[model samples]
Target chain A: MNTLRRSVSLIALVAVAACSKKQPPAPAPAPAPAPAPRVNQDSIDRANAAKAAAAAEAERQRLAAATAAEASRLDAARTAARAKLGMVIYFDYDKDEIREDQRVTLDAKVPILNANPDVKMRIAGHTDDRGSDEYNLALGQRRAAAVRRYMAARGVADGRFEVVSFGEQRPASPGESEDAWAKNRRAEFEITGGGTALKVP
Target chain B: MIKSARLLCVCCVCGLLSGLTPAQTRAQDTAVASGVRIGLTYDRHGKPGIAITPVSGPNADSVRAILIRDFDFSDRITVIAPDSGEPPTGALNYPLYAKLLATTVVQAVVTPAGALHVAVHDVAQKRVALVLDIALPTPAYSGDWRAVVHAAADSIEWIVTGQKGIAGTRVMYARNSGRSTQLWTVDSDGANARPVAGTENAMSPDWHPSGKKIVYDLLPDDGRHRIVVRDLTGATPTWSTGAASLNFSPVFTPDGSKVVFAAGNDATDLYEASPGSADPPRRLTSRKGSSNSSPTFSPDGRRIAFTSGLLGHPEVYITDADGSSSELLTASGFGDRLFRSNPAWSPDNRLVAFQSRINDVFQVMTISVRDNSTRQWTSDGANEDPSWAPDGRHLVFVSTRTGTKELWVLDLDTSRARQLTHGGRVQNPAWSPRLELSRQP
Candidate 1:
């Protein structure tokens, strides 16, 4: 019974000492700067360097793809802007009044014009090879003026539009038929300024 | 000798017995020079017979042929073949030509030193009526030959009719060939055609009174039409209105000191500009609700005839030089309102010619200023842009009778029309004034 008591007391003391070694005083705080093993630290440093290099290469590829995409987008936008500006609105024979069907064309221009305040356009009026040249000039002027007035009414400033008339002088079609004449009597829009920076969404 | 004496006696007796008036005396003198007797005179339909002898030199045949063709085109004389039996040199045998009833005999000879001697013999007068000696540097070329022969024909015409011929003058017009329109000038007989203006798509060319300059409208690829005054003497643009809202149908005033044209943005009206002047253009017409254009000054330079839509339809209107006293000139002639444009005042100041639309087809017509009697001059195809010749008896206009637009000249006396230009769409033929002697080539 004595031997058993001694052994139990010794085991308890060893257990207490192990606990104390594992759990030191709370005030002791000097372990953050301790150096790791040299061999293991070298391997860890090489791994981190490789990972960082991979990440940089990935970032460069991403930038190149983004730049190409941006260029393609800008090219497509320029083409679309040119097409929009090239849209022509036809008119009837010996008439300067814009028809109802042509309003849709004019309406499409309003947004583009409003979005680009720096854009300036020339509204040119052309007539079929009918009537006197002088009379045709006046008719073309009236047609161009009608277009300009419509745009001005639709929030476009008057200063942005330059109206001109080419009476029976410039024909869209060379034929003398009614269909050709109809195509010839038209109002065309030409972007005279700020075309280089045009963006179409 | 006896025949000559008898001829002189007969002429004196005829002069005394006829007791002719001044006009009649002039006609008789022309008939005597032509070798036609007074009683056996040719009627208006019958032209005086002329004989052009074969000239002996290089390219003489071509020169003679040109002379024959020109005389035939004159519409006042007939060319007869040379008699088979005739003297080759010296004085002509008037009796032989008299037997053939030839009125005038022309003898042309080319000297060795590139000179041409032309003699006109009057069979009835039994003497030489006129003589001309011209020096030609290049007699072998057709152009030089034609010029010399034209000069000789002009002299003959003057001696016979007391009026100069139009062979030496030129007519400027616009020609479009499915691609572009260019201004060109052709001789009255339609030879030596060449472009005058460098700008393409040119139209409505009007010659200055001096015949040294031309004013026209140029439509560039940029779709801007402007008035351009080109100097033919220097082959350069003396003045141009540049790019305007609308500038067209420019015409020189009678004095040629200013050019009146149509200019506007919304509504075109008449405006005058003095070429080479720093002053801006002066506005002439300002009628509201009316687009006035086609301004043509009168021969007196005091009045202007233009086309106005003030009456709901295009019609001819006359105004003072200051654009006041506007009067409607074509309203009373047409029963109903018709589209009348391209008003060109007659050089004689007696009539105004314009194109009137009837049944949707345009025809050239003229209305008398004094009596208001309208006469239709063209009925075939669509005819527009009538311009009067300097003589006031001929008109040059655009006609589509041959299925294409071409220039045609109409004679007021015979009511006949002759096509001038071949190939290409030609229009707005403005006949230049009588060219000075120095201007003829």
Candidate 2:
């Protein structure tokens, strides 16, 4: 609005001048625009410097965040692989013989064992509360031995495994239900040595 | 034909069963508690009816109550009711007890000198058969004197029947605590139940022949269980297997010379060593693929009866003490499956008591060693781990008949079971041999 007002006033002044001269007036050349207020060269350079610094800082933070997330993901994957190496395999009632369905679980451990020959494992057998603790101790040993035997047959070295039986003492679940009993009759694996760095199979 | 059932009602009220809690057994003498009929174990037709006469003096009521309960629990010598009225003030009217169908009468009087003056009178002979001056520990209702009273009762049974009773014995078992089973000892009558000192993780305790020590398997967290021998007196250092990977189901040779236990990390097998020495134990069972455990020495210590998981399921087997000539004792089938374990050879060496699975429930049964005749003693619930009283006619076992696992004593002749423990989930009862703290009549 100000610019337009200035322009209108300037045109009026020109027309008045032409009328006072008492000569035929045509559209005169528009007057030259006034000069902008002067700013120093150093000030312009300072503004450019601040903008560039802000952009660099934002880019650096994005790179750090991405790096942290990648490290965390790798850590979680290693932990999961180590836990899988110590997985539990369950059994049928009063049976030490491994079921066909559970073979996949044992099969999963073989490659992990093979990948890390230095690793030593402890395989413990357990039972439901159905039988005598003494008898269950024997039964648990059989189940654990059965597991160890399977691992050995699959090329796991005999020296790399330790077998034990907890009988019905250490149950995976509590109470007297079919589900609890089924969960209790199992062979559990634990890494005895060389477990710090697990190679996922 | 005695009214055994009617008296049994009073006996139950009196907590006549062996392992009922003390609070249950202490509710004694409801007027009819005086006359529980006892049946002699050896004789079938001659029950040998006996009357426990009323006594006089300090703790007379306590003395008479314990005496009568011991005889009633003897499962020998029929206990008849005393005469309705007292005999003439000075003397006992033997004729009255005889008229009550009592073949023998036990007259006890707590004398002024802290002695239970007892006389065993044969009613037919009309003469005093034997006299016992048993020292009566004052304040009999509590403390260890009850054991003395029980011993006095055993003496009476001994003199009258010519065979001693196991009234003075105690039962050892493991009671489940927080995460572990603790060692426990209770009187044979289910009185004086207390945990053995510092045996919180012990399982399956067996009594030493001398009754001065116990052997059990210590359950540690590392899966390296060891057989531990602890002296009850605590005067001697404890003995244990320092190297075995899994040692359990420990028992002492009947002669107290050696300890027999099972060790397995490779395969379950029996092992033996000097009970108090640190010598390496020699392996007893050689079967590699099978689990051979629960070793029980026969009476003469020449043979062992154990549970073997050789053929898919556990079965009872007898082998020489040298671990040779293993023979299957329980081979016949209930229905194509044989699940028998927890073998306890009788003290008389004639019967082997074990648990057999029937309909998925284990029941205590006895197999005659001589003839292979099997008799099932428990039916209502899962009953296993049968340990015999030294008398060979009674047994202590783990039974779930009452809904919780408990220790129960079974009279083989009467097929009667007495609950020995009501604590939380008890198992593996080992009845101690007769603690002969008193003179044999």
Candidate 3:
């Protein structure tokens, strides 16, 4: 009986020891800075690279803005030059000949010719849709010629100006009213050659 | 004496050669120049009274005079003076008569209806080769006389060229007015223009094989676009497409039985509609995420070439009429940087002509189907929207190089282009098919 009690006591002691759940000893503390060295270097390099990219992007945007500003300025200058060189001479209805009222416009256009002596211009004369195309074209030419003659009288060389007839080919605005016809019957100046290049070829 | 007489004979022969009468040779030249012979209308006195009134007014006299003086001008009939009760005797005698002096007689008259009537008579045939009438409102001043006379001359041009005159035809174009883009049609000479439809953002315009119907895209109040066919023959159009969605670039099959137009929102594809029916459109292209538009039918209706925006940007594509076996025709990768659009099939169906933006100017260019070679036809202006003349030897396009867009005709063979419309900005020309039956030869 004594032997049996001793063996059971020993088995119980072994089970208690297994159930105690003793933990393994913690690993020796690592050397102070080894764990995170590569991560820190990686983060620092990434931060530096991002800062450089941001600076480059900002610089690019500044350059783009400058380019855009320059383009806008050039466009404005061209528009101004075009306005100065252009002339719209009005005519009477069904007739492409210059009317007395249009002489004032012609007088104003003389300064442009004096300023741009070498500028070759095309005077496209137009008419309302009141007649056949061929008739309108011939009428338009006469109107352009009338402008040309006036320009010549104003001291512009004849060779600097060419005449084209758009007779009923384009309209300022579309309508059958007298207002439209009056607008359509006019000569417009187009700068064909020798003007400062507004946009490059 | 014999040697002197021989020398005199030689001198006489040389003198005869030198003294060939200038007036007599001029008469012979005139006879040769006027290439027609005419039988005159017999009168009671046997004198043909052909009266020519002065239609030349304003600046036309100078232009007409220039044309006549510079160009070869001939007459088929010689006018003789009238007898005493009328001015001269022997005016009716044929002994003094000569052969015809002109090929065609150009008659100019201001008709009773206030229209200018110009008739070209082939004197030998004694029949009118061409007659052109131009309607001009009575002038505020004396008369629109110069325009009328010039118009008459232009009408006679049809007789000389053997092509239908552009005087009576119309031009269709797109314009922006008061913040709205609309499709409009005007007289070929740029008169009587009004909005057909699409008062807001209209794009391509396809005329039915029948000149009566014009189909174009009309933007809806909701912002989506739909194709609408308007019959311009009536004062008000009859809308054929009852439903509205994102429909665009509609073209009729060669037979005009069905229309193939682009439909849908993101997945745009071609659809054909049967006449007078609201049947659901059958989808043609099957590729998902692919958008196809601007479908133009071949002359035989066997194939259609369209622009596809499937892979990034737009490219020209051709497919069978039933929408199968698709292939890409234009490869833009190699130095060809032009932006090509508006493919118009040639009248012969062997070539496709299109407008391309090159060096900031749009010009008409054509590609041959057999060799896939392309050639540019125009370079003078901001030319675009080329429509082939029915004869296939000419193309009419729009140009803005004059600082305004206008219709211009380019002769294919001559490589010469002339402006057609002057005062109005015209574009999107769809040339009519040759009339099935022209006025008999």
Candidate 4:
């Protein structure tokens, strides 16, 4: 009986050793859960920091592009204003009618005048030095009236425009050539009021 | 009328002198306060020859030169130089003057006290026609000497032709002096030229019938063209078309009571305004869509001649004083239908002179009111803005014949044109009436 009891005790000790090795697998699951929570928290903090930095960088780039676009738009508006102000409409000899080619120049003025409602403009008619001064004065007045009528038809108010006739007294180019006379027979526009707001390029 | 009276007085003087002895006649001529009178008749067959002896004293050469030039410019007389051996000073040499085929002889001498003595001899009448003595303020005043000579020449012209010469008168014109165009007045002989208007853009000056006022278009610095009636007696603006757009081509009525001008912004029309009226001007024309301008009244102030574009182009039109019964004076057959402007009525009440465009060039033309017959006086270079002299036998106009616009005077009888102003484009000549009131010694 004593020898049988001693052999059982040795078997029990072997089982105990095998159980201890199995116990390690169960604790490993518990510690694995704690370490997993810690690793997940650390990873979450790094991901959140990276996401905020990326969003800030994208916002900065967007603001830079928008500012560049606005500057370009203002520059273009100023250039167009300058061109519109300098535009002149030519007329035929001894005629006050507006030609088809001159419509384009007149059309460009409509938008500018409409955009600035408070602006007052002067439409001056000029003629070449060919006819009598008194007669030329009448012709120039007709030309200026024609221009005013055209602009009025295109929604420009009459109150904003003042028509004047320079007749043969003022010549754009002082000469007797056809080219110079053609230049002299023209309608010129001047912004008499509300011109301070126009940005110069 | 003054000439006929002077002629009668001269005949009486001749009758009285013929009854006296030669020595007694000389003593009576020196004692008579009236000038010596001799019956002088002009040769009708051709231009009469007048001999002028060489003058002596201070500024005598200049005076003689001026007299010769003025006589030549008269276009009514021919000057005959004395023979090489002829005496510079002498008594009546009627036979010798007749031998030279001269109807009249002029002798001038200056005394040591700076007094000018002029004598006119009638070759046919065999006597001195007239004698004039002028005292000079200073012997060194050459201008005064010229003036005295001009006055004598005028007197001689009146005695010969029954019409006063324009040598003592002045012509006002618009002179473009580089920076600005101003109104200037020059002696009829183109001497003593000076600006009458201030330094501003002025044009189309017209003289008052009284010769004491001027009406012109003044372009002020404010850019508004105004018709200003300026008084020469005071050198102040009597009236102005304030803020009127396109007011121009103003002329005083023949009676000098009203001013007719072209005024409008869209359709120009003639309007009459008083010199000092505060009321708005009276519209003289009612034509719509047609421009009427350059108004001039008849000598009687019963009719007005103006330029109108009613027929698609400018043409001269005449209307009653109230702008009624309009008649087209210029026909298509007279000139191109492009332009006719600057109408000036003659004092004789027979002709209306204007500038008409012919073949793209402007020329001076006249249309008789009775016959409607048109006659062109200028064909070379653009001639325009005709103004009749007081005598109605001559006209002052602007011409571009010398490649620059200048003032010129045309004699109707001789059809001769003489340049009056040189340099710097000039235009719009206005001949004044007899300026006896304004003549300065």
- Candidates sorted on TM-score, descending: 1, 2, 4, 3
lDDT of 2 at B69: 68
DockQ per model, Cα: 0.35, 0.34, 0.01, 0.23
Top candidate, metric lDDT = 2
Error of 1 at A81 (Å): 3.3
- Superposed Cα deviation of residue B356, candidate 3 (Å): 2.7
lDDT tens digits, residue span B1-441, model 2: 001211110001111112212322455532334336443222324667778766788877767777776777787777764535452255567777666777788777878887777777788888877776656443454434666677667766776677878777889898875367788887777766777777877888998887877899888766668788887647443788846556789899999888898887756899999965767899988998888899998999999999888876789999999999999999785555478999999998899999998988888888989999998888888888999888889999888788888888888888766777876588889998777453222
Candidate 4 on B183-266: residue-level lDDT in tens? 887666665456673526888888887777888988653346788987774546878874456788889888899998988766
lDDT of 4: 0.73
* lDDT comparing candidate 1 with the true structure: 0.73
Q: Output the better candidate (2/4) by lDDT.
A: 2
Q: iRMS of every model, one decimal?
A: 1.9, 1.7, 17.8, 2.3
Runs in model 3 lying further than 4 Å from the true structure: A1-201, B1-102, B113-119, B123-166, B197-203, B233-237, B240-245, B331-338, B420-427, B432-441
Give the better candidate number (1 or 2) by DockQ: 1
Clashes of each: 1, 6, 18, 0
**Best-first order by DockQ:** 1, 2, 4, 3
Docking quality level of the chain pair in candidate 1: acceptable
Tens-digit per-residue lDDT, A132-162, candidate 4: 7667777887787788889899998877877
> Which pairs clash in model 2?
B19-B419, B19-B420, B19-B421, B38-B78, B38-B79, B40-B77
